[model samples]
Target: MPRDPLSRLQWLVFALVSAVFTTVYIPQPVLPVLRQTFGVGEGTASLTVSAVVLGIALANLPFGALADRMAIRPILLTGGLVVAAAGVVSALAPTLPLLVGARFVQGLFVPALTTCLAAYLAKVMPAERLNVVMGSYVSATVVGGLSGRLLGGFVFPPGHWRWAFLVAAALLLAATLAAYVGLPVEDHEKARQAEGVRFRDVLFRHDLFRIYCVSAGGFFVFSSVFNYMPFYLHGAPFHWSTRAVTLLYLSYIVGVVAGPLAGRLSNRIGNGAAMVVGSLVFGAGLAVTLIPQGWAMALALALVCAGFFTIHASAAGALNRKLSTGRGRANAFYTLFYYLGGTAGITLSGHAYHLAGWHGVVALAAGVLLVPLSTGLVEMRLAQRDGSATRSSVARAR
Candidate 1:
C-alpha cells in the first residue's frame, strides 16, 4: 500500500508464498481429526504433514541448482501447476496411502515456489534493501502458515477436512497465475551471471554449515512442538475442542512482527548476537509450555513463534549476505536442512510423545536446542575475531 512502485510486486510475491505454505500446512490443525477419519495411529496421521516436508527436503537441492541455471518463470509455472494438481488429488484420495503420496508430490515442488523465488529475489534486489525485504519475505510465510491452520480447522472444520485441501489448491492456483504474470522476466545475462559457486563449495564451507545447522535446530524444535500439539491438548487435563486448538495458531501472528524486528535487530547488533538472544528466548518459551493453564500456554507459544522467527530471519540474512553467487544452491541447502530437521523432529517427537506425553517431546526438543545455541556462540566469537582483524588493518593503513 505504500507509494513504493515495488510494493505491488512484493504483494504478489507474498501471495504466492502464502498459497504454497497454506497448501503445505492445511493438514496440520486437523491431524487429530485425520487420525480418526483415516483410522490411523498418531504417527501415521502425522505423515500427512511430514511427508510434505520430506519431499521438500529431498527436492530442494535440485530446485536450488535449477534456479541458478534458468529463469524462475518456467520453474514457477510448472511447479505450481504440479503442486496444485497433486493437492486436488489429495482432496479426492480414497485411501490414506494415496493421500500421503499426493501430499508428498505437493512437497516435491514447493521449493520451486519458495526456494527458487528466494534465490531469484536475492539475485535481483538491491543489496541495501535485501535484509528488510527478506524479513518481509519471512513475514509472508507467517501469513501463509497461519492461514493454512485456520482454513483446515476453522473455516472448513475437521469433518470437512478434504474440502480444506480443495480450497487450498484453488488459492494456490490463483496466486501462481498472478506470480507468473507479475514477476519480471529474468534475462539471459542474469542467468549466465548466476553461475559459479559449485555444490561442494556450498556444502563444505564452515560458515554456511553453521548457518544450516542453526536452521535445522530451530525448525527441529519448532516443528516438534507444533505438530504434536493437537494430540497433547486433545488428551489429558486439557480436552479442548478442535476449534479451540486451532485458535491457538493465532499465536503465529507474533512471527509476522518478529521477522522484521529480527532483521532490524540483526542490523543493529549483528547476526551473531541477535541469534544468541533469540535462542535464549526460544528456550524459555519451550520451558514455559510446561505450565498447565491455557493463558500460560498461549503466551508461551507467542514467545516460541517470536523467538523462532527471530533466529530464522537472522540466519537467512546472514546466509544471503555471505553469498556472492550460487545463492539458489545456498538457499536450497538452507531449506534442505530446514525441512529435514522438521521431518526428523516430527518423527522423533512422535516417539517421544508416545513414551512420556508432551513432557517427553519437550525434553527431546530442549536437547536439540543446543545446536542453535552453540552455533550462535561460535558465530559471536567468529564475528569478534573478524572485527578485530578489520580494525587492525585500518590502523595499519592509517
Candidate 2:
C-alpha cells in the first residue's frame, strides 16, 4: 500500500505545538490583571512572562539533546502533558510566587514541544516541501499566540482569570491526545540518528554558525516588540482595554501571509537578502508605533508581525539547510539564544519604559533591530565573496 499522506499529520502536530507554546504567553496581555489580582507591581507581574521565557531559554539545550536520544512523539506528549498540568497549577496557585513558579515549570516543558516538533517535521517531510510546511507551522503559532492573549484579556474582566488557564489547559490536553493518536511512530534508530549528531560537530561548521547568529538576532528583534507593546499601550494617552489591547494581536494575521511569501521570496533573492529586507521592514514598522492613534498603532503592530515572521521563517529555513548534523541540538541552540534575547531584551525594555516612556521603548526596540540588520549585511558580503570565488573556479574549469 502507498504510504499515508503526511499533510494531516503535519497539521495536527502544528496545532499541538502551537497550543503548547501559546500557554506560556497567555498571561502577557493580562499582566495588569495579574498585578491587580495578586497585589503586585507591574514589574513583578511582568515576571510572569519573563520567568517562563527564562525557563524556555534554560531548558532548550537539554530537551533538544533528549530528542536526539529518545522518541520524538513521546517527548512531545510528555511535554504537552506537563504543560497542561502546569496550567492547572497556575490556575489554582494561591500566591503570585506560586503562579510564577508554575509558569517556570510550564516553560521548562515547552522546549520539548518546540525543538522536537521541528525535528520531527524535518524527518518526515520532503526537503522541497519543508519551507512551506514550516511556514504553516509558524502561522499556526501566531494564531495560537493571538488567541491566548485575546482569551486571557476577555476572561479577566469578569473576574474569571482562572478560566483563562483552565481553557488553555483544555486546549493543551486535546492537542496532546491528538498528537499521541495521530503522529506516526518512527523507528528509534532513525530518531536517534536524526538527533544523534554531536553538537560540537555541528558547531564546527562556519555556515551553521552564521545561520545561528542571524536566527538569534531575528528572534531578539521579534521578542522585543511582542513583550513590550502591550505595556506601552496600557500606558500613556491610549490606555487601551484588555479586549482592545488583545485585538492588537489580530495584526499577526499578516504573518499568516508574510511567512510563506518570504519563503518563496527567499528562493528568488536569497535568505540573506530576505533577512536584510525583512529587518528593514521590521524597523520601519517599529518606527510607525510613534504615530499617535489607535488605528495607526494597530497598523504598525501588523507591519511588525508581518516583517518579523518573514525574516523568522526564512532565517530558520536557512539554518536548517546549513546544519549537517545534530539538527535538533542546533535548533535548540537557536531557540536558547532566541528566548534568551526575549528574556533579556524585554526585561531591559521595562527599565527603558520606566525611564523614557513609550518613546524610550520605541527607540530601544528600533536600536535592537540594528543587531540583526548588521548581521544580515555581513552574511550578504560573505555570500558575495563565496559566489565570486565559485565563478572564478568555473571560468578556470572551462
Candidate 3:
C-alpha cells in the first residue's frame, strides 16, 4: 500500500461502512408500501426488518473471530458486494418471505465488514488518532442511515420504493469498489501462526467485559429514545402532525457531527474523560425533555444525539485499544452487546411508556445512564493509576 492510497483508505472504509448501514435500514421507511404491495399484515411486512436484525445479532461474534484468521480486505469486499446483491434480490422478490430471506442474508454478511474494519483500523492507525478516526466511522454510519430513510421519501413518491433499494445498491457497489482498490493487504503471515486460537482468548477479560457492557448499555438508551420518541410526539400537548413528526428525525443530523467531535475530544482528554462528558451531555438532554415547550424538546433531542454518538465513538476506540490480540473478537462482542441492549431497551421502554407514559420512559433512560457513568469514572481512574505506576517504575530505574 502506497502512502497516498493508505491515507485515503480510512475514508474509503468509512464510506464502505456507511453504505452497509444504509442498506441495512432501507426497509424501515418503506414498510407500509411493502405491506400493501405484498398484501401482508403489519407483522408479516415487518418481518423484512426483523429478519435482518436477527441475522446480524447472531453472526457478529463468529464473523469477527473469522476475520482474525483470514484476510479482512477480501471479506469486506465480499460482504459489500453480497449486501448489494441482496438488495437487488430483495427488490425483485415475488413473495414477502423471499424478500425477508434476502434481507436476512444482507444482515448476515455486513457484520463481517464492520467488525473487520474496526480491527483493521485499530491495527493501522496511530494509537492517538484511532479514537477520532473511529468517530468519523461512526459519523459515516449516521449519514448512511439518514440517507436511506430520506431516500425512501425521495424515490417512493414518483418511483416505486424498490427504486430506493436499487439506487442504494448501486451506490454501495461503488463504495465497495473504492474500498477494494484503496484498502491495504495484510503482510504479516510468514511469522505468525493461527493454531492456538481459542474462544476464551477474547471473552475472558474483566476490563473488556465491562467495556462491552458499557457499549450495550449506551446503545440501549440511545435506541430506546429513537424508537419510542415518535409515539410521544404523535400524542399529547404537542400533538404534532405526522409529517411534522417525521421532520423531527432531522435531529439525527446532529449525529453526523457528533462522532468527529467525540473523537477529537477523546484524543485530547482520553476516551474515559470524553465518554463521561458525553454521558453528562446525554443525561442533560434527557432531563431537558421535562420542559413543556416543543422547541426545547427539539434542542434536547439534538443534545441527546450528539452526546450518544460521542460516547459511542469513545466506546469503540476503548474496545479496540484494550486488546493487544483478538481485537476482532472484542469488537464482535461489543457490537453483539450493543444490539442486544437496543432490543431490550426498546421492549422495556415500550412497557414503561405503556404503564407510565413519557415520564416513565425518561426515568428509565436516566436510571440506566448511571451505570455507564460509574464505569467510565472507574476506567479513567484505573488508567491514571497505571500511568503513575509506569512513571514511578521509570524513575526507580533511573
Candidate 4:
C-alpha cells in the first residue's frame, strides 16, 4: 500500500475502533439515569453494560477463528451493521429488558470489529511496527471511550439519553461504511497460516496466559471503578450532577498519551518491567480514590486511567510479540478475557456497592489487582532468567 493511503487506512481503523468503543460505553455514564428510567436497582441497571461484555466474551472465539479464515472487509461490514442496528433497537426499545437485549446483540458482533481488526493489523503490519501501531490502536480506544461518556452524559440533555444511542448508532453506521470502502482486502492464502492451531493451544501457553491475565486483571479494576462511579458520586458527599460526573471521564485523555508511551516503555524495558510499573501506579491510584474530596477524585482517576492503559498497552504489545501465527485466535482470547473481567467486575462490584458502597467495591478491586501485580512479578523473574541464560550461551560461544 502507498504511504498516503496507508495513512488514511490507519485513520479509518482508528475511527472504526473509536466508534466501537463509543457504542460499547454509551450507557456507562448514564447508569444512574437508566436505573431511574427503568425503575430498577443499580445491579439490574448495570446489566446494560455487563450484558454487552458477556456477549463479547462469548462470541470472541468464533470471530477470532474467522479472522484467520476470512477477509476482514465483509466481517467489518457485517459486524458494524448488526451492532448499529442493535444500537438503534436499543434506542427504540420500550423497556429496559429490550434495551439490554439489544446491547447484548451488539456485543455478540463486536469481536468482528475489535479482535478481528486487531488480528488484521498484526498480519498486515511489519513486525517492527506492531507495538507502535497497537499503541495507536489503544489510544483510539481512549478517544472512543471518552467520546461515548460525554455523548451519553453531557451532549444529550437529561432524560434524552436515548438520543445518545441514536447518535452512536449513526456514527457506527458511518464508520462501518467508511471502513468497508477504505480497508484493504487481504488474501487468506497469503496471510500467515494458523494450520492446526486450536483455541486451547494459545490459552494454555504459560507466557500467553500471563499476558491474558494482565488483560483481565487490569480491566477488572478499571471497569469496577468506572462502571459504578455514577452511583458513587450521586449519593456521596459529592452529590455531583450527571454532567459533572461525565466531566471526570476527561481523565480518560491521559490514556491516549499513556497507551503510546507505555508501548515505547515496553519496547525499551520489556513488557514485564512495564507491567510492574503500571501495576504499582494502578494500585496507588485506586488507593487515592478513597479520599472524599472532588479534586482528589479527579486526580485519582487520572492516575487510574494512566495506570490501566499502561498495563493494557504493554500487555497487548507483549501478546503480539509472542505470536508467530494464529494471531486471530490469540487476540480473540485476549479480548475474551478482557471483557469477561469487565463483566465479572461489574457484576461482583454491584453487590459490593449495594452492601457497603464505594468502599466495598474498592476492597473487592484491591484483592483483584493482586492478579496483575503477581503476574508482573513472575514475568520479571522469567525475563531475568532468560536474559541470564542468553548471556551465558553467548559467553560460551565466544
TM-score of each: 0.94, 0.92, 0.80, 0.94
Q: What is candidate 3's lDDT per residue for 154-234, written digit by digit as tens?
A: 445523767878988998999988887776666556112343546677667888888888887888788667655655775
Candidate 3 Cα RMSD (Å): 4.2
Q: What's the residue-level lDDT of 216 in candidate 3?
A: 77
Global CA lDDT of candidate 4, please? 0.88
Please tell me which predicted candidate would have the highest lDDT against the true structure: 1
Evaluate model 4: give its TM-score: 0.94
Report how far off residue 5 is in candidate 3 (Å).
Answer: 1.8
RMSD to truth, every model:
2.0, 2.6, 4.2, 2.1
Give residue 207's lDDT in candidate 4 (0 to 100): 86
Counting clashing residue pairs in each candidate, in order, gives 0, 0, 0, 0
Candidate 4: residue 271 Cα off by (Å): 1.8
Question: Which residue pairs of candidate 2 clash?
Answer: none
| Stretches of candidate 3 exceeding 4 Å from the true structure | 1-3, 27-50, 92-100, 119-136, 153-160, 181-197, 236-243, 267-270, 290-292, 353-357, 381-398
